[model samples]
Target: MKLIIISGRSGSGKSTALQALEDVGFYCIDNLPAPLLPDLVNQILRDPDHPNKLAVSIDARNQHSNLKQFPDIYKRLRETRRLDCEVIYLDSSETTLLQRYSATRRKHPLSDDSQGLQQAISYEKQLLEPVSDLAAIRIDTTRLSLYELRDSIKLRVARRQEQELSLQFESFGYKHGIPLDVDFTFDVRCLPNPYWVPELRGYTGQEQPVIEFLEQQPEVQQMLADITGFLEKWLPLFEKNNRSYITVGIGCTGGQHRSVFLSERLAGHFRATMDNVQIRHRELN
Candidate 1:
């Protein structure tokens, strides 16, 4: 089994990271106390039908002060079980953590009458250093958006999947919002706003009327022509550069109409020719 121990500071998005792991198919346990790790691993190893990927979260909530216990447990587990273990350390700046605490209106785990959240955070950081240094992957969540963080975890998990060229196309609307996780963005407002047409306002480009309208417009034709040419020229280059995935985002005004249609069309285009492509309408109503 692949054992992943996710550890980090209190407000560094450890819960979010664990949820991301769970989303990607890992059997996840949240707030697992450090001292019980060895016994848990032993039980799992004894079960032949155990899950292939297992993730457990360890943090300040655990009363294990002997920081040395984690490495020792890991060494012993490695010797006994056919397990590959990796530690993922999630961390963020004190200022960001303080902001998170204030936003959530939650008291810090280590804070007391004399010490503030900042002080508590500092204390926890020192206490967790031994395990943090043992991490194979250390991620600073200070600047990471939730989607970006999830995508990062997915990328790591995807490494175990067969090595294949993958592409993800996402569609969104600027008014509803831009896709935060897009690697490349294309603005379709240049074509036409389907929102303007009273009849097509509620309909998406996946329908016949919207497709016919878009196909008739000179600008739409030109835009698709140019983008298709660009993809023909650049996709091979992306492969040459050793990229496993490329996300192309298409956006318009309202997510329900134009962007949805264009995204569907773009996905269909890639589906006919590309090797591996996953498409999602991020802001589709």
Candidate 2:
């Protein structure tokens, strides 16, 4: 059986991710007690009618002591040769989490009259460290819309083949905060800026005009070659190390031109030799 453990702070889109998996036929449970994980697995394995894919959400709502015991429980689960388990931890910036709660007018799971929302958010981070440390994939959902988050959970988590690394090339604007989930970040701000050209300003890196402009710059080609070469040399090592996912962040002043173009080029290059390659232009969406 394949088990996916979904966890994160409140308002970080954990519910959306769990729902996405459930939509794809994963039998999902929300707010499951951390201590019951072993029992849950055993029960599922014994039942002939059990679903092959199981997803559960465990968060700060669980008992503090139970949450602290997660690491040992996870270690034992990993030792079970027949059971395949992956933990997907979702988080967002504190400000973003605050904004989400305010927008939705929902009560935080750990908030009360004595402890404010901000304090609860901060405390939850400390409380869930055990589970977060065991996560195979950490998703930062601060800038992702609900639809984008759903698509990401479906494509990056649900559709990924077992033991194959799900590699993602994401482009973003430096004006916006750097993505927290990326394993590596490349700054392309030093490269030529197509946004300066009046005609190309309106076009994105994916467009022919902007693409043509970037292709003509010698520096752009050199940067692409350098980044591509670096990944080519290192990616094999990560695969050999049994990595399940890798996210590379490429950023420019604005996501429209340089970063997006480079991300597209890199993804294309890796896709030629790798499976499960995906590209996302954050500002575009």
Name the candidate that leads on lDDT. 2
Off by over 4 Å in 2: none
lDDT of 1: 0.75
Off by over 4 Å in 1: 161-285
Name the best candidate (by TM-score): 2
**lDDT of candidates 1 onward, in order:** 0.75, 0.93
Residue lDDT tens for model 1, 145-191 = 78876776776543444335566666777875555446678898877
| Clash count, one per candidate | 0, 0
Error of 1 at 184 (Å): 25
Estimate, for each residue in 121-226, the C-alpha lDDT of model 2 and write its tens digit: 9999999999999888899998889899999999988998888889999999999879989999999999989888898899999999999999999999999999
* Model 1, residue 178: C-alpha shift (Å): 26
All candidates: CA RMSD (Å): 7.7, 1.0
Error in Å for residue 174 of model 2: 1.0
